[model samples]
Target: MINTWPKNGRALYTRETVITAIRKTITAVGCVAALTAGAVACGTEQQLSPGKQLSNAFDAMGKQHSLSVEMGLDATPDQLIAMSKGSDEPMPPAMAKAMSKLKVTFSAQSKKALADTEQGDVTGSSMKISGGEGDLVEGRFIGDTVYYRVDLKAFAKMTGSPAPTKEDLDAKLPKGLGFADKILDGEWVKVDTKAMKKAAEKQSKANGGSGVTGGKDGKDGKDGKTPSGKPTLSEQSQKKILEELKGVVNHEVTIKDGGKHDGADHVVATAPFRTVLKSVFDKLRPFADEMSPGGAAKMPKEEDFKEIPDAKVSVDFALKKGKLSAASMDLAPLAEKAKIKGEVPLRMTFDDSADNVTAPANATAIDPEEMIAGAMSLASGARGATGHGGVHGADTSLYTG
Candidate 1:
């Protein structure tokens, strides 16, 4: 139904955002490679340099009709806690005990071609946060809607909060009556992005906002401006980003042959931890400045990142029968800044996912305004309950997939 996973929206810090960062990083590398892929003298795939091979593999995955990516944490909860905390000192006993109960595995299936990242493109993805008994939370993105639900008791246990009883829902659902029990059962909820967009546009207009409202035509605008007036990355911005990232990709990121993994040919892409981040930031500063003329980029200074040592961050891409099958990255380097030392591996596997990413049937759709109304009703002692079937958005950020 509606995406109500703990708003952090990830099982591990590594699953979505980290993988997104990795994808963006690698996509920049592939962009630069695409520029040269045609011009370079053709050669056998085996003869290509590590960087070129990686670029080609990344490109090949992008060219697929549709793809799926599965990412998971291979470390124990204790290790995850240490890496997450980034502290040299031991975690408080209570905190460690509580965190250790979590399940860090997550999977996502998507229908978009990797390189077809243009705005307004219709892509679908589904994610599940695995738990010992079942999924703690899950969500699916189908076109302009997202469906999500959480196991109330499991989520409550994970967060160390009391599970919302049907009574809790009844308290807010004076008009809806005994409907809270069914909702608390974790029925799917969907949020219509189109509706959200319309509401946002109306609210923006009411507030005297001048930005273009995004829809079919306004998704991508001139000068990297989106409908919200926020800078949407343009091809040129990507080019600038690629220019900054190309050097490290070529010189620092190395690819080596790993004989076999999961019955597939594996290729490793390695780079220095601090080197890539610094270079990425350094090159991005000018373009970030260009976006909002005269304002300094809010990116961190070099000195601010001194905690991260120049450790190697290796990403392994797997090819099965010459097709991209899976990929994984070691996340230990990121945790080193926290004074934690150990391997924190996150693996992502790919597949054909077009037929699999369908929207769920019978999802209860709720608008954001209804959510606001519901919240106000709760605060006002539920006397002013709306006539609608009330289901407020769930704040399930502790484990988002």
Candidate 2:
């Protein structure tokens, strides 16, 4: 107590009290120092140029081996009606009625590894399209396969069909009517991965080795050999893309405080839709001419391009802990300007703690071959019905002039 008080003090504090006061003072100083350091760091980050920040963000994203992505469309009833009205063709009454009652938002999320870009298992995935009363459809993907469950009662109401059951879905169709026979029983429809792969391969072969895994001109090698794998852009090509993006976009940096994106610094890049689209169209003009009968004459002029309303496309990247943590793209401005009153938002988040995907048990397998055959049969029947000579062709005898 004697050491705690100065010589001038009338009353000396106890030794324990002095110790407590010293500890409290030290804690307060430490907290203030921490706050000052944090503020300094934040200011330093804010001072970074947007381009440099983008490069750092891209580098971080490239290093990530696993990520989760969420994408969705949000639309109100009025928006839906507006979109339908904007369409070239008149909306059917039934469809219009459905749209009027529809207050739905569709969303999907997937967690997957990016170690192998060509093929990676989706460890976990889910999609839900909810409206009026509840979810109209719900689906999940595990490993290489995806399964979806439809609300039969809701679907029946929309399609003006009687209440549907598993038996109704599995029922045998008329001999020539092969369209709906592939529909599976029960609530879930499981898509087979192996079958899908085989189908894709078959299609690739049929298309002269030019499919999803083919090269620029659609062929694999110079001599139209089977594709070894999908062609990846060269480093130079990637650099060129980055350069083009930087040229077109205007970038700005800002700090986000609190909420889901708390304490992270963000870099936002925005570009006018018309300008970007015009550049793309110009690059593709030569190819467009080759594909069209009138060549460049058939191409739309700059005035025509102007018909597309001016809008901005914004992309926001969030950086945290000196690394890129998440990014999002917003197309709302563009959509709104085009008189399309709906929004399609895409967001992706990176995580280093993700585990490998495991195949699900009790999943029902489906046959891709059977589905393809059924689709072809239906297509043939449609051609015939339309007077193109298939199944129910228009009677030429009745057209006697």
Candidate 3:
């Protein structure tokens, strides 16, 4: 049989992106922990090491709990602007004269994960954003990866109109595709740092960082000019550069302290939240600036991000057998009145084969790209029919594990 998933390509998103999802997944998984934490405290005598407890609790929960979670997303201004620019035909004078409009919403769901090994179900929604309504998108996660669906019509509806199918959607696919896929797969590509280093070095020298004789800090000047006819960095300046470089390169992360979250002690893992976006932009900016009508599209670098300050995930339970019973969980997104609101619902159940089993079969590897494309197409159509806008406004569903 054709593998249900692919095997050899890099995952669509980076570690950080996956981690973000994991953190979000925790909201739903937390419910199981909430109950189990109490049981765990009662079962253990000497204070358990926070880190060990985290490992142990998750282990237990994984064996016994499964949860259902959902989330909502709101589009950034850039996405809305891009959407409004899409059209089925070249704008006529009258239509061209009218300003384009757009808006958006986003969200997702996952069946039981962190709570238990018994597989569970998760479903959620998304929509195309515009001034009126948004498109709809949704998903289900059974094992290691998620299966998502999206509605494009709802996206079109956000602008107070029906979204065109096929052709019109295809026209807008190129630019919107990447963002859509990234959102669906919840990942971004890694950058080639080696290339970035070369670019950075060339740019630095071009900006007058070459050393020469009789320079302000180095060798004698030739014809009253440095070898590259540019000024070099002073020893202090270079030292400062080196110091700053050390901070970002090859930094190590370790958990040194344990803290309380949701009324229980847990280990804290810390690391730099770097991304490939920085390096990609760094290498391309020069070329983009030198050519093209777009005038070097301004892309945000990873460093431009501000730390979220309090993002965290906690382990409350561990199910050793991967057969969750009496497991309970409620991710905030899933708690919305539109979804399941009372007494955390039993969302999914998994077979023992999926529990604590590392290494999902390489043969069944998921194609994040395919998953994204399928989801966007589905979202486009769903939006058109429902007049919804984006994932945030889409309907939620329960599924079998």
Candidate 4:
């Protein structure tokens, strides 16, 4: 077996390294929490209107201490192609193939009783670009730690790394990174959340302050300071934008099937693509001008916006037991823009019966820095082995000459 520690007695992992490895995961969960919080703040009033009822559902959802979320997306090949047309960068052939076969689904159940305490489990799978089915990865979060159970063979294949052995991990990894011993033994890898939080705080301080607030000039009123130093939307501004949207988009409300859906309410909203786009652009013109090269002179014309074919966006909301149970958005206009034959739909549903999340048992804690160092070591070893020499001997002629 490889030695876990080196002679230097220095730790291999650092707060920064661990934070970077899991930042994306944290952001994803944070977004869900933010959305729930927004709904609660926006819909706390007692009202019976259809819109108010929808808002009330969101409020209830926000109040739940624990809930489950399921999200899914399915795109046909044509729809995928249409989606790719929006990207400025060219998609590699392999990636394009993977996108064509893409079918993504994920679900999580989370609970938070205190600001410092939270827990959840996430699981998901996608179709592989190759002919085989993709492996499902599962993770559990408790307190400030996350434990992941991954299929080693599939992980190696996806990452283009050799299947890691216990010896390799022990020898190559630093003591902090050696948390992989459990993973090598076919168990989960534990990540330290406290370290991640510390790193995040350090990063914020280094970047000049908490990223959530603006300078003394009130550049960021609330919601958080944006990089552009522009003012965030105020409630008054938001209401005005909603009014504009109302003028452009049609709204409808209907009682959904009472028997099948447990007496839930449904709200359907639709808007003409061109009209909505124009209204949005008009609202954003000031900001765009500030950021654009030629300012107001280069502002896009209404005529230019009119080039898009007239199509519609449909958003559906379902409320049950005074809580938002499900929501969906369909943007069919973009398909027409790309001259494709299908629509891409996104959907999410909430379940409030989730049990409290718990940390995985017997998980080995690993330092983030150690994992990174181990990967680098493996890569370096591979490169050295492939140098311009046969296994039998090195050619001295090139170096001497």
Q: For each candidate, what TM-score against the reference?
A: 0.66, 0.52, 0.25, 0.50
Clashing pairs in 1: 1-147, 1-148, 1-189, 1-190, 2-189, 5-396, 6-396, 6-397, 7-397, 86-338
lDDT of 2 at 135: 54
lDDT score, candidate 2: 0.45
The best-first sequence of candidates by TM-score reads: 1, 2, 4, 3
Q: Per-residue alpha-carbon lDDT of model 2 for 209-252, expressed as tens digits? A: 65544555554556544334433556665555444433332231
lDDT of 4 at 392: 26
lDDT of 4 by residue, 1-401 (tens): 11112334322222122223234223322333333233323332321345466556666765655566654444454565555575443333333333333222333343343222333322211111121226335676555667776555543443322455665455443456545666655577777867754554455557667532344563543544333254355666667655543333322112222223546676554445555556656765665534532345556688887555456555566777677787655544544546556555555677776655566577777765455455555544434334553122321110011
Native-structure RMSD, model 4: 12.1
Considering every candidate listed, which one attains the maximal lDDT? 1
lDDT for predicted candidate 4 compared with the true structure: 0.46
**Which candidate leads in TM-score?**
1
Candidate 4 regions with alpha-carbon error over 4 angstroms:
1-48, 85-135, 155-186, 196-264, 271-312, 372-401
Off by over 4 Å in 1: 1-47, 81-114, 117-123, 169-183, 204-240, 289-309, 337-342, 375-401
Question: Least lDDT summed over 10 consecutive residues: which range in candidate 2?
Answer: 392-401
